[model samples]
Target: DQIFSSALTAALMVGLAALLCGAVLYPVVVHLSADNEQKAREVLDSHISMMEALGRAIAKRDSDTGAHNYRVAWIAAGIAEKMGIEGNTMQALIAGSFLHDVGKIGIPDAILLKPGKLDDTEMAIMRTHVDQGKDIVIGAGWLDGAQDVVAGHHEKWNGSGYPARLQGEAIALSARIFAVADVFDALCSKRPYKEPMSFEASMAILEKDTGSHFDPGVMAVFKPMARAIYDQLADCDEEATRKLLQDRVKHHFEQ
Candidate 1:
């Protein structure tokens, strides 16, 4: 009887110890998990900040406000959202739109900042920005989605574009959407080369080039929202535009 009682006691003690250890470890596990999540968020935030800084640097280098990218991103996201584009696709569109000009960073100021039309040689160099931008984006693991826009934004619908000359559907969808947003913003924003066009006139230009310069399908979705998006960003300063774009990016990527 004594031997049996000792064995029973030993088993009960072992079981109790295990239960107590688990109870103690549960909170620790939860705390560690929370810490890891926070660290991940911090890392992601850092990466995004770096990208934004690089994009804005390009904008400043070209003597344009970073607002150009902000407006383009907003327009792209709006069109994408209306088309029910969600998940990684939408995130890529937003990110790629902002970094689309990253390749221009490689161009010399003499060629990039020229006020007049680029000669054939200069134009050739300028065209290489697309490939350069693609290479830059491809090097960064976090910027994988930006490759399409960075590589193909200058491509035309009729196969008359630069770098690759990819025609029609051969071009990436993100780049197609970006082309529309880019031209829209460029026309609406005043530049040293020309005055800003009215929304109607801008639409006319976009409509005229449908199926030639832009993807007809993407243009169809963007037509309705074009005026509204332009109006919203028309008066926004650079800081406000950046804040708006950052919020939209965070909503899509962080969630």
Candidate 2:
């Protein structure tokens, strides 16, 4: 009986030792996991920063001040939220807005930088940017989400637009949302070919193109917020606008 009791006590001591060790190691393992996660995020953030920088570079190449892309991103995100677009899909819209013109990087300077209107041949070459842009985004593992927008941003609602001529809902919703924001910013911002239109004029143009150029449903949601979005972003510079939109991407996409 004495020996059995001693053995039992020893077994209990061994079990307690194991339990104590596990208890001590649990928090350490958790901390290590957290550190690993943080490191992974840092790596991802670095990739995103590089990708965004590339977007800005592409914008500059296209003779833009680079603020246009950021503003478009801001507008697209807001419109998307209003339209109840959320999750990874919404991230695609925002990212695609930034990188939409990335394919312009491939276009020759003569055509892409021409201050005047593109002639028929030049227009054909320019339109190839959408497909090029899709290839660029789709090839990048991290940016694969942006494929829809990059490929279809120029597509018209009535199937009159380029590349695939995708119509209505057949076009990815992200691209549809982006089209509205893209034209809105384009109309409001000064370009080499045209002067910036006034808010009222811009709204008029947007309203006129509702079904032909943009998704009617998306436009319906955007019409009410257009002026407000412009007011909030009109005064911001490229860097300021980029930072604001970057924060949105980090919050919505990176999280």
Candidate 3:
């Protein structure tokens, strides 16, 4: 009887201990989950902040009206997402979109922020950002996946764009899509060199570029989303722009 009772007591104690452990650990598990989510948000937020800082740097360098890069990046990401990109590829697109001009950081100020058309020599120096950007991000070990964006965003479809001049299907899709968004935003937004173009005029320009300057298929993907894209462009802010930029660079080349 004693032995049986002792065995039973041990079993009961084990069960009680397990129950206590579960009860105690449940809240800890919940806390950890919450903490993990918060951390993820912070990480995302940090990336956005970094993107914004970069944009501001560009604006400072060029005496920009401010927030154009942010807004353009927002529009670019919208177009990309609407086209069905997701996951890391989407993120890379976002990051690359913001950093596409990062190479400008290396361009001579005379060419980079020039309010007038660049002379051939200046243009030559200006285009080096593509390679310069590639080198910059490639050297930055912490910015994983940024190298492709830094290097390839300048590539154009039909092999007309600068730097590598990679031909169709060879150009990074993000760059192809970005070429449209970036140029469109520039056309529509006020700049030091020229007054902003009317929305109608901008559309006409994009339409004119069609197959030559922009990707025909991506342009089609963008056409239906114009209104949504416009809404997003209007809604953008520095904070939002930063987020869009990060997602763009992160997603661009993967899909």
- Model 1 has a clash total of 0
Pairs of residues at least 3 apart in sequence or in different chains that clash in candidate 2:
none
lDDT of 2: 0.87
* Residue 253 shift from truth in candidate 3, angstroms: 17
Each candidate's clash count: 0, 0, 23
Query: Candidate 2 regions off by >4 Å?
Result: 1-22
lDDT of 3 at 135: 74
How do all models score by TM-score? 0.89, 0.89, 0.79
Model 1, position 235, has a per-residue lDDT of 88
Winner by lDDT: 1
lDDT of 1 at 187: 90
Model 1 C-alpha lDDT versus the unseen true structure: 0.88
TM-score of 1: 0.89
Scored by CA lDDT, what does every candidate get?
Answer: 0.88, 0.87, 0.71
Comparison by lDDT, 1 against 2, better one: 1
Per-residue CA lDDT of model 3 for 1-255, tens digit only, reads 999999999999999999999999999999999999888767766766676577567667766624766676667778877888767766666666666777677777777767777888888888787887677666553354556556766666677777778878787777777778887788877655678777778888888888887889988988777756665565566667666555655445322
